[model samples]
Target: MIETAILTPLEEELFALVNALEQFGFKKHKSLLGSLEIFEFHELNLLLALGGHGKTQFGVQSQYLLCQLPQVELLICAGAAGALSNELEIGDIVAATATVEHDYNLKFVNRPLPRFTGTPQVIDTLKQLPRTEWDFRLHFGLIASGDEDVVTVERGQELAYLTGCVAVAWEGVGGARSSQFAQKQYVELRGITDTANHCAAADFEVNLASAMFNLAKLIVRWQAAKDYCAV
Candidate 1:
């Protein structure tokens, strides 16, 4: 069984499987920091939680909570991202085989920070699933995760150039760091709903749902597989 975690309600709906929901709590920890909700489908276990922006502070906290579990296997993160590359279209999916912190790079100034990397296990798992040509395309590339919501085209391009990544999302870098410490295979998937240029006046909530809906299809499919295997 592979254990997974989603960071938001939008991500929860986007990646939930058809399993009974289980509630969990952090010991003496306030829910304001984060909550624990596990969903079980077939024999697979998933932990769904959220991470808010505060200089990756929430992520470090989440990692501490996950350490208490000591049984989580794989981590999958799904969220909305701003498209930085011209090759990506709105509502399209970008599956990350690897993730890096965009703001951590300082090689130009003689500072080198170790980048957290994910394994190929995610690609292998997706390959196990039946391949059907779907409406949205799945692109595997470098994803830059950070705090700021990219809202300018120039900023998007600059970040893309800095990280050499195609997409930008808010929380995956934190997830990547935590997952690395857990020695779990990490898979970060994202959907682009707006170009940085259009994000200035876009309805973020609506776009977030659109991305979640796109991920929901995969969730349902995984759930169906779980049910079938149980039979």
Candidate 2:
């Protein structure tokens, strides 16, 4: 009875995953968390919902819902991210070994809160997934999440230097905080869609749709594993 919680921050990603879940024949029980609608797949008690950009309020609401579930053991925050390093290509997945709030700093004050960072626990469930199931390559590194998007090269490098994080995204921190505080195992799956270069790269347009689609497929695989073990 291992319940899993899947959260996406964007509507398009949520819709894609919901539709794909239906194709897998799972009926979603609907509910609302403030203004956000959450769909729970009944058989596995897995929760699905969106946490809009830097929407810490919505993320907190969603986590409260997950807390109500008796068996939720894992929390997955999956979505698109912009790459900061040259080695990463579009559509590749970066599974975070650790995560931090890169935007938090103490330059204006004596010191910031001590809770801004940590060594995230490794995701054992993701590790159990057979490597041949998907065509995506997975990298383990520090994922920097914050309220702002890393749209500029200078900002990206600065944040990376400040946090010693390899990549940055807009929503992972809020989602990560709630999940970790709730005592659930957490893992972030970021599909790289844009480079830190800022300028629209020709490859970005070609890769984004596929990255979104593939992310859905990966979620389905995760759902299947949880669904299988429950039986």
Candidate 3:
């Protein structure tokens, strides 16, 4: 029986991970969405969706597709994010404690304050993983999500101050919202691919591969722990 679904924003983020899974007996199944990859691991069914970048695409795909996969007990959004905090370096991972839509607001009507928290049981499960011998550090904190790519030091600082988020991404908030609406346990794991600054693009291009691969490794380790099955 399939119980988990994973969503990634781009193929670059998931390609290496998908290839690695094939060695562990995960076979792909054809999916409705042209780029969607459905894999089976033992009795577990996993759906990997390519949501593209930005909140609109992510939210639409997540809500529409999750409804089709009613067997999913846990939904995870894993990908790369820009580091908003100076404490984070390239390849560091942050398991989002909560995701906030930093761009959501109604001028003169509402302020941008909506946040979606990770499911407590799932967060606990992630916390129990062995940390010894890990190459990069793992952090748990707020992740700010918005439509715009943060590429300036000033903007990054402003966002970090406003949301108190250590990382920023395009899809986390949207994915979290969709999972929440489906009443499914949700978690987001993001690897730092760049520091949000003038050099963000070059930094991301250089570090994205490692960051994504690390995320895949984390997911594999989490699955091996078998903690998610209890959720």
Candidate 4:
């Protein structure tokens, strides 16, 4: 049974994690989820998949994979996110203790917002390590996801104030929703690629590499710690 799966939104991110996970002697595997790489560590098997770049792509892919592979208990959607918090610097990690679809509004229908919670088992697994083990600070807080690539300080502030998210990104909510529908555990881990501001695009390009590296490094290091594996 495939106990856990890691989904990334971009090719660069996919490869960065692949490189980091290679140390565990992973090998390519085929499935309805398309081409995937599998690695086993701490008695937990992690299959990595690329969901491409958006809520639609991520939702469709995650649901399809979970439907196809019912054994997968935890689905982790990890990638880059913009920092909405001034304290969060580039390259820091944000393990979403909760996720909210900030742009989703059903107020016209008197419906509540679509909000998702992360698996505490996964969060505790990440928190198991001491701060010194993490080269960068690891933040556990809310992450707001939407279809928009957040680029304005006003929009960033609005989302943070509304959803109580420290970081923002696209696609993670898709995974969160999909996992909720499938009745599976979910976790979203993001790296700060830029501050949600007018310069977001330029800053993302400049910091993406290190952000990805740090993300990959954190996952690998987490497994290496062998403190917990909730697959």
- Candidate 4, residue 221: Cα displacement in angstroms equals 2.8
lDDT of 4 by residue, 1-231 (tens): 557888898877777767655544555454444554333343335677887799989998888888878999999998889999998999999999988888887755866567788988779878886667566789999999888988898999998888889999999989998999999999999989899899998987788777877877777667656534433
Tell how far residue 141 is off in model 3, in angstroms.
Answer: 0.1
lDDT tens readout by residue for model 3, 56-154: 788777777678777888888888899998889888999999998898876788555899999888788788899786788889999998888899999
Model 4: residues with Cα > 4 Å off, grouped in runs: 23-44, 225-231
**Global lDDT scores for all candidate models:** 0.62, 0.69, 0.81, 0.81
lDDT measured at residue 200 in model 1 versus the true structure, 0 to 100: 36
Clashes of each: 0, 0, 1, 0
Model 2 error, position 42 (Å): 4.4
Model 1 segments beyond 4 Å from truth? Answer: 9-44, 105-114, 127-133, 198-203, 222-231
Question: Please, what is the TM-score per model?
Answer: 0.75, 0.78, 0.90, 0.87
List candidate 2 stretches off by more than 4 Å: 22-35, 42-45, 67-70, 108-122, 200-207, 223-231
RMSD of each: 5.8, 3.6, 2.4, 2.9
- In candidate 4, position 222 carries an lDDT of 71
